[model samples]
Target: MEELGISLSFSRPRVSNDNAFAESIFSSIFSVREWVDQFIAWYNTEHRHSGIKYVTPNQRHFGLADDICEIRRSTYEEAKRKHPKRWSRHIKSWQQPEIVKINHPRPIKSVEA
Candidate 1:
C-alpha cells in the first residue's frame, strides 16, 4: 500500500486487532466456497466497508454514497439466509458441542472399489 502512497501502518505482528478491519473484509469475501471472482466483483461494487465509514470502497473511490448501508445490510442478510446451515454451524460450533458433533451424512462406499 505504501508503494501506492496509501501510507501503511500496523501493530506488532502477533496482534491482529490492528488490521481487524481489513481482515474482516477478507473473511467476508473468502468464507464462501463458491465462485470467488463473482464474490470479488460483488464485494467491490456492493459491500460497504466500515473502515471507510460505512461507504462502499467503490462509492468512496467514486464519491457516490447513497443507501449503501441498507443495501449492504440486506445483501449480507440474504447471503446468510441463502446458506443457513453453513452459517449456523459457523456461528454455533464454538459454543455448542452437539452442533459440533452433528456429522454430515457420509456418502456410500463405491461398489466398484
Candidate 2:
C-alpha cells in the first residue's frame, strides 16, 4: 500500500462514511457494471450534494461554485428578511464548506490526572 502511495488507517467497524455513500450507489436499481458510467454522470452533473452546500460536483469542477453559493445566500437572505419572525436567530448558511473530510478522526481531549 505504501509503494502505491496509499496510506492505510484502521477505522472502527461500520464507521466509514465513504462506505455508506458507496453502498447507496451500489444498492440502486441499476446493475453496477452496466450502469456505473451513467451513475457517475448523474452523480457529478445532476446530484446536489449537501456536503458541498448543495452544489453539483460539475459546478465546482467548472469554477461555478462561488456563483451558485452566492445565489443560494441571496435567496436565504431574502426569505429571512421577508419573514423575520419565522427565524429564531440567523438564517441557514448557504456558504460552501471550506473543507470536506471523509472518515476523519475526532479530536481527543486529554484529562488532567
Candidate maximizing lDDT: 2
TM-score for candidate 2:
0.60
lDDT of 2 at 58: 90
Clashing pairs in 2: none
Per-residue lDDT of candidate 2, residues 1-113 (tens digit)? 55787654444433446366566877774576658888899999999988888888899878898898898889889988999888888877777777776578999999999
What lDDT score belongs to each candidate, Candidate 1 first?
Answer: 0.58, 0.79
Q: What digit string (tens of lDDT, one per residue) describes model 1 on residues 1-113?
A: 54577544556544537888888888887766457877887887888654454555677566454454456556666777888765743321111111212256778988884
- List clashing residue pairs in candidate 1: none
RMSD of each: 21.3, 16.7
